[model samples]
Target: MARIISLEDVLKDQIKEINQLEMVTSFIQNKEELKDSLIQAQNDIEDLSIGVLGLKKDLEKMKEHNVSQRKLMALYQQLDDRIIHMTNNFPESLTQQLDRQEEKLNPIIKEKTPNSYKKPLAIVTNSDLTKCEPIITGDSIVKDCRKMLFKDPEDSYIIKELSDSEFSKIPKYMIGRQTLSTVNAFITTINQIMKFKYGILALGKVGARKKGELNLYLEFKKEESDLKAANQEGEIYFFNADDYERETNSKLDKTKLNLLTVLRHCKRIHEIRLGKNVKYRVITS
Candidate 1:
């Protein structure tokens, strides 16, 4: 076995060693490339995670903004409703104030007007009239007159004079004082007068040359319609008893047709007093 050494054999052994070294070097280079690829993949994953986090935060902000917008819209709606309510009610409030001021100045106005120019007026009260009929027919006559007046409109001047004449027939003391009994009696008398004096013309069934005299009747009819409409819509319609009496040439007692009794009987009616003036309304459901 420890035989003769050959130079060719030694050279072949040296060449095998060189091939093995080359294989080791190739394996090291491959290991380094694989490590670099792993590091790059880790960095990419981290970047993706950061991007996802940012998107989540943005989504949260957008949700908050949407909620804020909804709240703002609700506030705007409330403001709009308030404005509409004010607009609708302002004119009536102003008119009431003006009427009060006029009442305060009435004595001065009467004094200024000459006695000769002032016409002799017939002042009547609801209490002064007697009820001859059990049923009140004035309601139907009022409605009919309104329809007729609207059918053929007349001059404002003539209408004003007629209205003034009717109002003058009511006494100053009894203008605001009304009782249910008195009102009923007054209505009965009015119905009787309309039927006996005017006949078919009382309900405006026939045309007349004095159409302007029906202006007050038309106004009352309109008011009744307005009250009915308001009640249907679940709203309240109110008026001052004194102002109503003056306009309609009627009187009422303190107990019978008083605001409280009317409210109790009608169910829809409500009462409130501002100073001396009593305000009534048929409330909404």
Candidate 2:
């Protein structure tokens, strides 16, 4: 009976050892599979990294191929700038030459002219503006200091020809009821603006309506010979082609030139001496 019991205990011990060994073998196999999966994931990440690098290189090459287009765009910008420089003050070609002289007409003979302009620098109360009351627009109205050194009253009449007040019976923009003081002030203002701002550049002489002549005319045509004519009172400036285009809403063309000619002859057209070369610049706001 003792022998039988001992043998049974030995058999139970053997069975327990076998079960433990089986568990250990299963755990080891699972760990090996996990290691294999980790290795495969690392390989996939490296392959994906290589593909991304290749795509980046292709994009860089595409950008490099656009060099000519980039250069062309730069060239277009420069050409546009040159166009503005040339046409900024004289955007439109001239219908009448600058040297073309008209027969001296008194007060521009209300017959051939239209009424007052929409935004005139100066206005006259009647047909014979030289003898009648004139109204002008501006901040300052007196040419107390810089008298435009004009050569002839006829050329000065060319400046005075800008006003044609007989168009409308009523004054459109003038205020103060045409009183004595108001009329004088308006005349002063027009003369000042023309002499200082709107007048053209002249070497030896600047043309403006002289004092007490009872004529109308400051025009953008100033005496270039003496820019300090007025002893520095008004604002004088130059504008780039871009700004001129923006203000006028057109490129430099024949139509645009007519508008510019009117402005230059009446207001201020741009002509400057740049390094010994005479060039036109946009000198108005």
Candidate 3:
């Protein structure tokens, strides 16, 4: 007797294995379906958010146009009323003629009147900022600004003084122009741009002789809010230079530090020598 196998018992074991396999297959199918559903749901949410924003803009435009229509209608009605008032003293026949003309004019006016004074416009168009300007980001500008101002990002931030030539380098970074006049305006503009784009006061120039410097000192801070000085010797101060008729009121010295002041600081270089592209037979030495 070799365990006395029965057909009914063997059939029962096989049925149980088949049921387990079916369950595993169903589970895998459900997992993939769930993933697809999640992706679809995420896309639907983004679409809905964009639609809601578009609806808000359209509402504003509708309101503005409606108000404009009301204004035009009011003006037309006022003119009609004025004409009627003037003709009150005239003959009844003439006044009746004016009334009839007014009735005819009202329909024509309504047809000719524009909802807005400007050209007919469609509803507010969608403008998605993320879809455009992949280049004008903080990551790129910060490095350029840091490199231009400090030369080295990790270097000390204590650039206490800058001559007129040194100060002139800031305008192109701020407004992308080299025609800005006065050192006072240059620093102010650069700080304004930095504040809006970077959300911090990046630089400050102080020209107070009563305290210390006769020229503008380029004080770069990490943030808009006041921060502790990086070192004990570095103390920040301010004064009104216009009232002081002394050295502080005098303009920053235009003396450039080096011969490279006139150079536009281009990145690419072009140079050639007669030594190159020449062939000579070597004589035995």
TM-score of 2: 0.21
For all predictions, the C-alpha RMSD in Å is 25.5, 23.4, 29.7
Q: Which residue ranges in model 2 land beyond 4 Å of their true spot?
A: 1-27, 62-70, 89-285
Error of 2 at 151 (Å): 71
* lDDT score, candidate 2: 0.44
Winner by lDDT: 1
lDDT per residue for candidate 1 within 175-251, as digits (tens), equals 45654454445434433432322222234411222344465445444554655654434423344454345545676
Per-model TM-score, in order, reads: 0.24, 0.21, 0.22
Candidate 1 off by > 4 Å:
1-28, 93-285
Which stretches in model 3 have alpha-carbon errors above 4 Å?
Answer: 1-29, 89-285
Clashing pairs in 3: none
lDDT of 1 at 140: 52
Global lDDT of each candidate: 0.50, 0.44, 0.40
lDDT of 3 by residue, 1-285 (tens): 579989999999999999999998888879888889999999999999999999999999999999999999999999999999887767889878999999888765433221122322222223322222233565563212322222321122111223566546544544243342433343343233322222112222221222243232222232111223323123222211121223234532332111112221321111111233211111110
